[model samples]
Target: MAFGRRRFLAVLSTTAAVLGLASPSAERAAAATVCPLALSVSAQVSPPGGSPYTVCSGVVPSFDGTPLDVDVSLPQDSSGPLPLMVMLNGWGHDKTDFESTTPAGNGANTYHWNNAWFTGKGFAVLNFTSRGFHRSCGKDPATGYTYATDPACAGRADWTHLADRRWEVHDTQFLAGLLVDAGVAAPDKVVTTGDSYGGGQSWLLALSQDKVMTPDGTSVPWTSPKGVPLHLAAAVPQYAWTDLAQALIDNGRGSDGLSGAPGDGPHEDPVGVAKESYLDGLYALGTEYGQYAADDPTADIPGWHARITAGEPYGKDPLINQIVRQLADYRSPYDMPVPPASVRIPVLSIQGTTDPLFPAVHTAQMVNRLQAAAPGYPVWTFYGDLGHSYADNPHQVWAAANDEANDWLDAVLAGSQPTTARTTLSTTACMPGQTNATLTADRFSRLANGSWTFTGSTGAVTTSSIPDGTEAAAVDPIANSGCRTTPAQSDRGVASWVFDPPSPGIITGSPVVHVTATPQGADAELAARLFDIDPASGTQTLITRSVYRVTGSPGNVQPLAFELWPAGWQLQSGHRLRLELTQSDAPTWRPDNETSSLTLSPPVLTVPVRTS
Candidate 1:
């Protein structure tokens, strides 16, 4: 991530020749008509034997006059306005995630999509550091690096709003508008694509359409500093969340009464369970690599993490619930008003079936809502086993998904129909030496054409009073890079059911579970896991799971119904589908700290299967 100075005069001379300008002065005069802000050329990057591209690195003032670090890469041969691709990074990462050749945070390799690659594809790539990360008005407390120079942030740190529409999303729109005004990018051919945190921003940008939300909470036409109108042509959001609350702190009570299924309206109250490990990991990364406005009372990042980490009595604190809900709802695209069809654009959402953080369900919910609101809007989704967790075929899945996304973008820019299917699902390679397979359907639900149900009452299963050690240890989304084994049943807190399919098939959707539970304390939680038990080796591979929080009188019987995280895996004839109902799945999920238990009746498990 070196930004060595390049010969600016010589580069400008060369750019003039490429642009057919008579001299450097002519090129400067031509650019002066469109570009009002000063730009500095930091470095020139060329992919091995490829045409060199200029990387102009500088700062752009956002809506509130906050300086945002930005890098604009332009190909030498491109003439007139070029199609733009705004490359974004994940949580706790900066623009370097798309610049450097080396791997950065979260195993993100630049070879996948870099400045040179996009420039080679005839696109002008814009990569910028999000606010409170690296150089964009950020101060890493751990390293004593400061970029907070705004007058409002003079006495304190300028914290990240976690991609709030009014801040991070607006910053992107404003930057894109600048590029459009500078005559560097086409006004109608701009696309936003990113992973994880940036993925969330990508979703927001697409939803915002031709308008941007102002600091005063009003919507205005997206325009540049020079008054040039702009809009997003397409968006490719990978491993993103439609609803922040449902993704991070889920209550498992969806509006449709089907637990994890896409609800009919905005997410309701009763703040959900905390995903302790993921939340803590992100907060730590922010503090270590980025910056946090820890002392700012208006900042919610510090306060939200602290309150959730305090543990237990979750629903009892009314103020804490308000903080959590307000923070999540404002940042979630699911809660936003549906955009009109006139401004809506094409979207190709890519998600990981194995991603524990933002699973396929998030994208599914978004696609469902979008289609419901604006029918035939050219929205497509590709679900594969490539994300935060272990992927059976990482390289293969990654390549295919990215290739599909690029093809979709190409088609959009060309004003043609894409050849890729509307909905594509990739199954994990369960058997030794077997390659992952993909299936196509018109809709997400069609991928799972059939189901297998196990119903009947057995005996009540009680949970352990302790939270940590007594809980079953399953897949660590961060640590387990390779396929790992999980226990089918634990001694104290886990209730298990084994179902043997009559024939071989593929399970391709979320599994719904129903049970009647009586809480030993005022509040209780249940973690459900679905595993594929190999009949020959007697090994269990964790497929998908989710956690549900139960709140009621101590002895009241609550009929708990929820869907496990969606997954796609091939099941053998002799292999068994084991459903484990446990009180806690530690590290991955924060268990209730109270010394309480949940007594459950025999559960009914319904798993979706694909015959063809």
Candidate 2:
């Protein structure tokens, strides 16, 4: 049954009273009669053995008049002004990602749960095709994905701004406002969420509080067309990035040291090493499944990919530095202003410990900032083995992560304290029948009670050959981007060290590595990998890893300190801890390509450990 504006509102009011639910006020009902944007109801779908819900799909003009295809699903059995859940899609994906019933792989499918599932929970879910993707005034001829020509988007080719707060983020706020004005969503009870790309957007929305940037770059309070104020009650950003620049191309600069904790130094002026595999994969997906702004330097996917992968003179190139600065300033939540305590939205951030694209450290950094800026704000983080990479226990972790997020959302909406811990870290169990255990703490740093350090030194290693191992292949951005294990191999151009723990323990935080190195060339790059080596068979399970890039005068010795991606790994008694440093971790990170060598003094490895 197709319900027009008046019929929908009438049904809502009548059903609400019949069901003894709160009915919309007469003022709200009257205001619903006049919607600012023209909305057309296409179909009313009823899931098998479930209540019917209306699905409305149409083009909505964004901040700059860019037409965005939006889908709104509302439960027919529910009353008006229901809690709103604005679901977003990942990069190169469309609104259908959340609407479709197909399960997303990689143990990160919670965000892909269909719209009906949420509407069944009394949530008015809104999904939209982000700017520059299919149905959002862009077309990919290869995939035959094209939308009906809308005059408003006549000259708007390749308009994706890469989730710029002023663009894609504003689009979501604008659409939510319309729903509020139409009495379809509760103005104060809205939540934003999504995975990967959408996760990043959700984070920015939470940081935005109730403010939005106008098309002209002016910041203003978020309000509906009818003047109803809008605010996000909560945000769940799964496997998201706080800093797009650091995520895609990372400089080793980590968060400022947590009080009394050893942290990486301040952000120095340096262009980071590009994650070639992910960058290539994303660029291809954008061009194939969506649209890319090839000519627009700021939004040009191809240009950015080429410049990043070109390699060398990294910190010296002004254009590359400009690109990094622009990405961080325009696309990173790290640069956004934290909301004051009065308006700070509760955030439940779920990240993957082994996700090479955006690791647990990303969320940890954001959490630290939030804690410092808005003390005691309701921000919880859950890290597991999931996301764009492979997981050792996909089903178990996926279910657990989803449960945590759901409970968090429920608690925040009910204005009750969440029973869940402030931080939860789940380790990837590598052995058969091994329990994938969890560790909880009040803060990220507190996850590890103490640490174990191994001191060592190695001969000169050169970036002449690709590292040999399954770990490298498994973590490759394109080939086998997931967690995997194989027999540990000590090969040429690889610096290796092994440590035998006297007792069973858990490595629970980011591993810090400090090396004094003398470069053979103008620049040097290193990929560090930590593994769990089976005592008997020597089988190795990849725990976590990171890539570091640096430029210096040849033969000049400099102290290099960096942290690997944060992880939670249980080490059995008698099992060994192995650390390997190589020149290239191909397909995961772009190889430095130059035949440069590094002469390093004894390196120090500090691992945060907890023994119960």
As for candidate 2, its clashing pairs are 390-482
C-alpha TM-scores of all predictions: 0.88, 0.88
Q: What is the C-alpha local distance difference test score of candidate 1?
A: 0.71
Candidate 1 contains a number of clashing pairs equal to: 0
**Where does candidate 1 have its weakest 10-residue lDDT segment?**
1-10
Candidate 2 lDDT over residue span 1-612, tens digit each: 000000111222233345443324423433343322575554455444344566666888875678888878777646778999998988877775566321222234553345756777788889888888877866746456564454667665437788888888988998899888777899999899887889999998988868888756688999987788887999998789998888887766765233333564443346667788778777776765566665776666667778888877675577686677668777888877877777888999988887778878889888888787777978999888777755433677777877777887788899999988999888876564345798888888887878887887455444443456545665554345444677766655578888776678888878888887777865667778888888677687778888777677887888888888888788887788788887777777777756777776667888888888
Please give, for residues 1-612, the per-residue lDDT of candidate 1 as tens digits.
Answer: 101111011332243355443345433433433222466755544445344566677777776777777878777556648888898877777775565311111133233456667777788889888888866767545456676444534543346878878778888888888877778888888898887788888888888868888866688998877888887999988788889878777777543223244343334345667888788878887776566665644356777788887777766587576665565655787877778877777899888787888877788778877777777768899988766655543666766777777788888888899888999988887555345789998888888778888874568878754654532545766665546575444445467777777677888878888899898875776888888887677678787888777778889898877777777888876788878777777777887778678888888887788876
Candidate 1 local Cα displacement, residue 455, angstroms = 3.0
Clash statistics: count for each candidate:
0, 1
| Candidate 1 Cα outliers beyond 4 Å, as residue runs | 1-37, 49-51, 100-112, 139-144, 148-157, 254-268, 294-298, 391-393, 430-434, 468-471, 487-489
Best by lDDT: 2
